[model samples]
Target: MINSKIRFVTALALAASATAVYSHGDVAPQEVDTEGLKELPKDEWLSENPYRGNKEAIEIGASAYNQNCARCHGLEAMSGGIAPDLRELTKFDDEYFVNKVRNGVQRNGMTYMPGFEDVMGQEAIWAIRSYIDKRHYEYKDKDLAELYEQAE
Candidate 1:
């Protein structure tokens, strides 16, 4: 019985490791073109999201979030046991978003998230914020039972 229990534990560990390795590719950052977005001052950081309700921005933001954030944050801003559910974020709170993204969370000698300020421009980041905002509004009003039904 002891040997059987040890084998089960070992199998579970191997399965979890394999899943993590397979999903690692989805976590890499990708370049996004913010063509229609208005470029902000390079040295100046805006206090709020500039493209909150713009239709074009919503589209761009959706794509950008999928490319750079979906792996951890989950598809459509849902949390998949790896990262926070961005859908629960305060609506249009650009300051918090910007600061968090610019200076990623780190604690106890471990990096929880990496800073993306150097890799993505303000326009791209704001676009992602816009997408999260949209997703929040989309799912926030749904009944919890409905959500559970949809999940099935």
Candidate 2:
């Protein structure tokens, strides 16, 4: 039994390590411009646009945030459920926020969010994030800060 267990463990480790993993080395060999890719013009994309910084969009976003995001995320993006607070999305840039929210970070234990590209549309997602930013980070108070740190 012990030998079988050890063999199973070794096989599991090997299988995990043998998976295709990309590093900086993979960039050059694959003709990938890692920096260029990282520096892609997110400002041009709605995902990183900061959502026109308009109050109207924000209000609409707040409604969206409340309706779709509140139950799992929190009352005001504060995050009381299994989901993390959406407020701290400001910690990352537009691309990161957009990609994560849009793509649904499966590795981060989030796969149920469903890609919003078709459903919510890119503009709406950023607006939601922008609203979350204002509520949780931009207009932050003590309680929200504590929540932010908790996520970190």
Candidate 3:
């Protein structure tokens, strides 16, 4: 009886551990389609987002962000404690935004976020930034909690 109980507990523990390990689901980065946006120079990255405030770019960005970033960054650029709230990025300049997205975030040798420079071009990156910027402007006046409540 004692051996059976121990085995049962061990099996339960393994099941819980497996669940936790796979909790995040797929971690693969999805590709962003930047068609209809202007093509940027391939040789050098721009310091500022060229697509900023462009209506078509903003629309494309919304879809790209949802596909690639909404999982961790939260929907509509709001954060759920998993990642930094991207809307707060409005305080920073465009250069900072571009660099961060291209290079991604890393600390203590662990990749917090993977760099997209290899997979995504400047146009797509700028589109995502543009989308984030729009979200920032929309909620800049209202309380963040209010936005969260509205989302629910």
The number of the candidate with the highest lDDT is: 3
User: What is the C-alpha local distance difference test score of each model?
Assistant: 0.79, 0.56, 0.81
In model 1, residue pairs whose N, Cα or C atoms come closer than 3 Å (at least 3 residues apart or on different chains), thus clashing, are none
Write model 3 residue lDDT over 30-138, tens digit each, in one string: 6888888888999999887677677778888899888778888998989999998988876357898788778999999999888888878888988888888778878
| TM-scores, all models, native as reference | 0.79, 0.54, 0.77
Estimate, for each residue in 1-152, the C-alpha lDDT of model 2 and write its tens digit: 99999999999988877663421122211111122111324345553544434455566667766656665676777776568767666535667777866666576674656555545555566566657766755545535444333321
lDDT value, candidate 3, whole model: 0.81
Find the candidate with the highest TM-score and give its number: 1
Q: Write the per-residue lDDT of candidate 1 for residues 1-152, one digit (tens) a residue.
A: 99999999999999999988897575656778999777887998888887776666778989988888887788898898888888887654679888888788798989888888888888888888877777876777844333223211
Of the pair 2 and 3, which is ahead by TM-score?
Answer: 3
Span of ten consecutive residues with least summed lDDT in model 1: 143-152
Q: Candidate 2: where are CA atoms >4 Å away? A: 1-44, 108-110, 142-152
Inter-residue clash pairs, candidate 3: none
